[model samples]
Target: MGGERVGRGRGTPLRAVAYAAGGVVLLAGCASMPDSGDLRGVESTPRQDTQVRVFAMPPSEDASSAQIVQGFLEALTSDDPDYKTARQYLTPEAAKTWRPELSTTVLSDVPDAQPDRPDQDDTGSLTYTLTGTKVATVDAQQAYAPASGAYNKLVHLTKRTKSGEWRIDEVPQGVVMGKSDFQRNYMSVDKYYFASNTPGAGEGFLPTAVADPVYVRSHVDPTTRMVRSLIGGPTNWLKPAVRSSFPPGTALREDTGALTPDDRGRLTVPLNDEAAEVGTARCEEMAAQLLLTLRTLSPAVEEAELRTGDRQLCTLSQKGADDVAGRGALHRPGYLYFVDDEHRLVRIAAGGSDSQPDPVPGALGEGEKALRSVAVARDERTAAGVSLDGGSLYVGSLAPGGALGEPVLRSRGKTEEDRLTAPSWDAQGGLWVADRDPGEPGLYLLAEGAEEPLRVRTPDLDGRVRAVRVAADGVRIALVVEKGDRRSLLVGRIDRSPADGGTDEGQAVTVVGLRSATPELEQVTAMSWAGDSRLVVVGREQGGVEQMRYVAVDGSTPDVPPPAALTGVKAVTASEDERAPLVAYSVDGIVRLPSGAQWQKVTEGTAPVYPG
Candidate 1:
């Protein structure tokens, strides 16, 4: 748990003052206030809720070693910007070296401090062992990952010879707290990045923004913190799949502090010299990333201006930012489509769940061929459907006079359950599907829906892929895999490069680095990409009831509460647009759950879906 030290400048001591006007007595720490100089306004986002503030109390006189350890633990959970009060429990030497920002060890519950016998020769000193069940960890990068096993650490305290007071001399490098405290003190924010090695604007594909979510301290200067994290780059897991627009070593100008939007909803960011010379196009892209990331924190921020020293690099409004990169949230699907009771592809207005659904304009919607499942392209111009028997997949335009093309791909499995899973369309106009055929099980991809379906390599897969959904960024894919009798959700990175010793036509396509996104769930029935880096999943824990929850791509649960519960959820679908209603097919037929509302029946339909 050793960590590098971060410098904290010493300031003046506390003082007592009396105000003549109000007869108010104040005992304030001079170190907490800025020194007399040119005053600058530091704006901040208002607290979202009226959460009670808890301040850590300094150790009392003659406190025992155990008391010191307990107080320090409590202080770690307080909102003490720099853990100043926690240092009061440590010896001056220890206080100078401890680094609470290195990482956060989250336990299942508050740790138990057990006293340990002192050295026989050094009876004046005492030690306490902290023990708990480790639940997860947030690294220095503020990335959260699920962890398991016992947490054991030692806190060594020494008695000051002159005062005979117990002070901790040695402790773990980083802070430790329970899961609840971690949730209370931190929040998840998705910083934007562009997908790497993808088609560009000239190729008819807009560079898509991929979300890289990381946890940051809540109630702190989160806007500035998030901007810094964005400039720092994506997390380790997503680094290979995405690239930041900021140049290497780019960072916020050291003098700029606590970024907040002005009265007109404009945020100006001052960057280091590394970004000063970037071209207008690249600078605008960088501003676009900043605008999208900060909009999640402050919706009032309508525009962003980037500066280096006194020179303005670029200024981008919200609409300009949208044109620079395709943020999935900006492209809301117009309708929620599903396989109706008539087994035809029909759609209802996305906003009006109660509105009547009409068959889509195409051969599949004409009922010439019954469909089992379907996926519409992000553009809503073309659609792919799996036949009722699940043996064939057909692609056709969504226009009135468009004809259904012949089966683009077919599976020869013995039963419907062993045939093709639901199809998914990526942002690059590519199509994805998985075959559950035991004899020839595989994941397949069709580039632009015209080329022959290529077999995607899943070298890390442990079981048969039961379902598949490609994210809007096209850099990642979600999979429901079955092994033995259990099913689990896994997210994998998609890599497309030319195959070794082969031409461009034989590109090497693989879904690699598969990691469990829902390790707690014993079975996953269905899932859908609900947001930038989040998935709405339907699953049940071992020996537990079915439930729906949002899981981030990093394999950590988001801070949001689970959606309203529904029973027997067979299929679930959500739009990348967070404002869109959540649609699902359960025992009660097709149902929709609007934001802040309970599930309501939409129609007697199955295989409900939103444009991928």
Candidate 2:
């Protein structure tokens, strides 16, 4: 379990003295403020006639932020531990926006008792303290009814739709709840600009210098709370206005330092001061998001710094990776991938030119150039090298030292073996390699640290092999094959009887039948597993338009209908969280799932890679 902070109740008064009678002036770059009001006693009172109901609506299809939080709380009591309800609330676009989060799940211990039935209790109360909020925009077009509240020994619940009108919703205890009045006012103008969009910008408050947009994000374990890595953004542009920092919930105001540039020209903002002031828990996440939007018509960085009173704290920056040489190219870089703890790939990033391109503007510098080269080298399997995990990174590749010259690896066999292509990791801590062995072309598995190979042959497989991916659990593998100008999908499960422990039958369940027998998919290039049974395949259609398709593996029940069809998928990568499996596809530029409600442009033009 992680650290916990206990709030007295929803209505506890905010503590801490006000900065001044005039109210703390938020200098342009300064975003920090001292706690006002009585923090220790802050609380909330339930609405009148507090009737609660437990609605059994379907889970979100894409599990956006709202669904994620709701599903998480629901898991604490319901007998059915699924995310279906979460998915039901999302529209196709919104579902796709939050598709990644849909795959992740949270487990909680059930309470000993639940509240009484909805018909009886007006106020719904539970014993556990709620710590987080889920925000989601509901659709006005759809109408949903809340379920009847049920009480057992677990939790109490009563709920009903608010006047039968749909509303994009958030938890009652969410941050939005506190600022509801302000939000109502702000939205009244139809739109309000945040970050660079704020008017009247200038230096010290708003200036101009930026980092390309596109940052790698990692989430905290057990909670799925996100922690964004500040990669190649312009740190020096807004170094002066830095101030106090906060972790998830704690705030700090003292001891923070300045931002420094490393030998590689990368910026390193000292977090020691912010950590000391806010405490590690909250300050750790304070600077996790991009402080300012670098790209704008005017391009001015304002309030560029986030100051907490007198101290110059964290700096601001822009984000994005650049690839000057690879600009305008349409190739799948297999760079976005994830594996188990041992560096064995449980999944792979699947998508092609049909996927989207990076949305943020910017190209890679010389250091970025060197790092990307090494990542490809480490991912090579023919040379008996180590497999790379999406979560487990190669630090040397990201930040090199001395003249070791970019951490390149040696090739296996005669120094002339065909260049390694389509390299991927498997769940059993092995590397899956595809090649043509003298008229017999197929895929093979190379276990960790084992030079010798155990071949995986599927004689029934026809045509040339396009791509292969091993599932997270290592229970099955997805293989794309082309036969007679037509493509087909095959799911092969290791066939071993309870008694016959030695060899495999080499049998596979054909997933593509009537649908896969089309000539339009002739250009199929790659495939990735999105879930235990769902697969995302990338290929070109009749017009050479790139496309990504989803299929569910159900060999035992072949009669089941196929998955829904979705196009405009450019490049798809497996998300760090299984519940939110696919992400960051590009159409013209790269667009990724930022949360459940929006698709953020992460990069534009040829995408650049952030070292490590």
Candidate 3:
């Protein structure tokens, strides 16, 4: 994941912390701070300002059943705070029962309204089959997961006795909005959660916060809603993997109003009586969580204070939050490195610079053995690489006078991607390699000091694992898998056994819940984790050129401008900092952005990387 420090990240990632008690302040050390040089900036084309249409009155009284169906679908797309206008399309009785916040079904296109019986024009029943792909679904609990196939919905309408209006009788709760409309009406937000601080990678128990991406009402006080959702708890899938400092059943004091920050960027969350039962330390934990979650907003709240009615609790400032950020738990490598023409590992400084590529000290620099792809350990003292023939994997020390070691893991496949993929190092110092062996493809894990690699069985990943990068968390893996001609980016949870009773490498660290993080990218050639929870992807659509953009692991792509272009790129890499400029190995050479200034060439290299 080889460099020592990163420049400032893309956005100020959610470095804020959460607490349980009153502001005693936490001590979770995140990452090693790197001296950010002049941070490179991209002068992206300005975003087009567009005004969204809010909900209007319901369909007219004389509207047809199909008209009402189509109008209701369009109304769902509108940024209506309450479903009042949409309720107009529904029967008075049904309006009171329907709940649109249950789940958000995001379709690639608008819903296609079709009569169950096309021949019956006066029939009371109509179906709105979602068009394009389902893309992803955001449940009522604010959990986002990638979903495929169709979202065919049946809606029944009954004529209103008083107004003679064609009103929807029964339909599912939650809105079904088109992707375009979803983009306009909803916002992609991240609520923060604490990483499980189990000791690993010889670093002991270091804590860090992870971002859980979800969609919310963009115009609605989104910042406050994020806090509300945080108190509600993490999604079902991530609950086991993450920790929340807030006490269970903790909620905002106000049941209906949106929690807002003051002009000083201080947001105070008023909790229920449950907070009173909790201790002061726990109160600080609660405040830390609020600080981290609220800071993800556009106009971020810099500080958070907890309260019960008028009584003030602990206050968590940015400094206290930063103190416990725990980001450093996942070490960022020191420099940008890649395989040179001589098949030796070489290096250059990160960020936008025209630094000459130099051979890294050690066996990798000697190029005694031909190397295809390589990954450096977080310690910067060891490396793993795939042989030029793609038949074997090798790990050696980066220290001076070291030599390439024997094959740690080997492949028996026929294709390049199958035989061996790029080796990756996790924060735990585990070396991960994928054997594409089309005949019996599999992913294997090898921890430091372990002799044999343990086979990792992943769901639906039969022989399709194209690239593997272990995240800093050490418990998750990001794989670029190919299915037919289409490629999708997915993140899988690596659930290790309850205790360390078995072989470290062979221990059953089950890789479960393979969720798509970049379903929109038609083909993903390479990818790297940008921050604690975000990923920088290198791919193109069905016919687009290789480009790079940032995407959240929950299949949520940021609403920023188009990604920077990397012409003829075969692979890409970036500093752990989300804000750092990306480095790519185009057909020409190694390139880094704000290309607006110029994607300065570092050298001729591929597989440039930093310690994961």
Candidate 4:
């Protein structure tokens, strides 16, 4: 197995992971690229959730300069529309000039309760310091990026002569808020985009939806803002990688009108004259994008229509939308493979009854050698096996009578803890695995038919990469790196650079976009890609017990809990299905779940995996 030792009943199993205090801190900045298509008839409006409340009011006027600065910081957490109350803390001119939408620095710690007095009073204008240990930031462009260290912020206030009140004159373009209040006032919403390589990708692999995290009003019409944000291009960080399908210069036809869903959950959106130029195929693509993006909103969208100045563009069905983005590509594994007590490969049909697990006709499958865990390719045409001792990785066809190839990827670790992680496969049939050799840690990638594995680099990941899972989109990676006795769950964007002279691009990852995806979880031990943007992880809090939950790449947790608890769990895995069945290797043995449906034991096993 990938761990130091396989778990046995009541034995000292492998160590677990921990998480950040409180729930995961999902910072603001979620929005989809605006672009929707023609409905056969008129495009529908969006649904507005009326229950969300407006933001809290700012400190009363005539407050002290420092108090006004403090009140402005607090108002940043409110869900007010247009941030009018937050603006009240600013001088009217500054209010007109200040752009809070520039970016939001989400502090992992609390802001200073009292601002540091100004270094020098500049006549009527005074400056105060508000700094904290920064966690992450969402910019005006809606780009989310992680930032470390203490943020040095200064809010400059001016004494207003008219009301004898002090108001902020100049401050950072973005807003700043403490983590706890951020949770209370903010919510996470996904903006839909097609994968860069999918059929809907007019160019390369494009994300159909961009999940945007924002401080949505708790009781007002969040739908309008979500749609507006969608029409806006993806946040700046993801812009280089993904493109929006919305027409050039596209915009809502109405400036002040809100888009609301009808009783049947159908939305009609009115676009300006610019969107009137798309063809039928383009219109369908756009509508599909809207269907997926709007589905995350309250009252949800079942179907939708598009309109240009009341002139019907076209309509799209839910199924059509799903098909366009290939969202229905989820397929359960044909057979669940595991290693048995005798060090042989075994399997259980995904839909079979409680029958004794069976072995196959290959070398490893027929008990040729002791194996630790297994990885099946997405095509299910081939598989990879790790040596029971964790020193080697072998690849072979999954068919009966298939001969397991020589070790395709080998490890050079001095101890069991430094062996290779469970191998993962990307969409392009590339094998990705990492060596946990603490003294010489490295990541390797092997494409089909390659003679040897090529080493890939992790720029800022200084610790041991315990686990690695590539997303179905083939652009992002979910990794667990253990460092300084702590583990973190992070998301890295893959950069495929052109190799020397015109060869395929060399695959490398940058530390810049590698954001801390699971801040709530401190020591993440095991992780698997649950969907394109979410991961089902097993982790614990610092000095706390282990727990399993589904968290987004943006540090947002699922609305519901994960499957039942399995103490002494050594490894857990799931298929690409967002709600797919989970297979775990507990101290008891190999178990599969649908929850409460008895964990049908297959055989004695340590590691298990499904096609990504």
**What would the per-residue lDDT of candidate 1 be over residues 339-426, giving only the tens digit for each residue?**
9878889999996846578999978799878999999999998899999999999998898988987899999999999999999998
Residue 101 of model 3: what lDDT? 87
Q: Evaluated with lDDT, which candidate comes out highest? A: 1
TM-score of candidate 2 relative to the true fold: 0.30
Candidate with top TM-score is 1
- Per-residue lDDT of model 4, residues 529-593, tens digit only: 77655678888887789887787777655545676777766778877664557878887887777
Residue pairs in clash, model 1: none
How does each model score on lDDT?
0.82, 0.30, 0.68, 0.65
lDDT of 3 at 491: 88
lDDT of 2 at 502: 38
| Model 2: per-residue Cα lDDT over 101-123, one tens digit each | 22111111111111122123223
Q: Quickly count the clashes in candidate 4.
A: 62
**Of candidates 4 and 3, the better by lDDT:** 3
RMSD of 3: 13.8
Query: By TM-score, is 1 or 4 better?
Result: 1
Residue 189 lDDT in model 2?
6
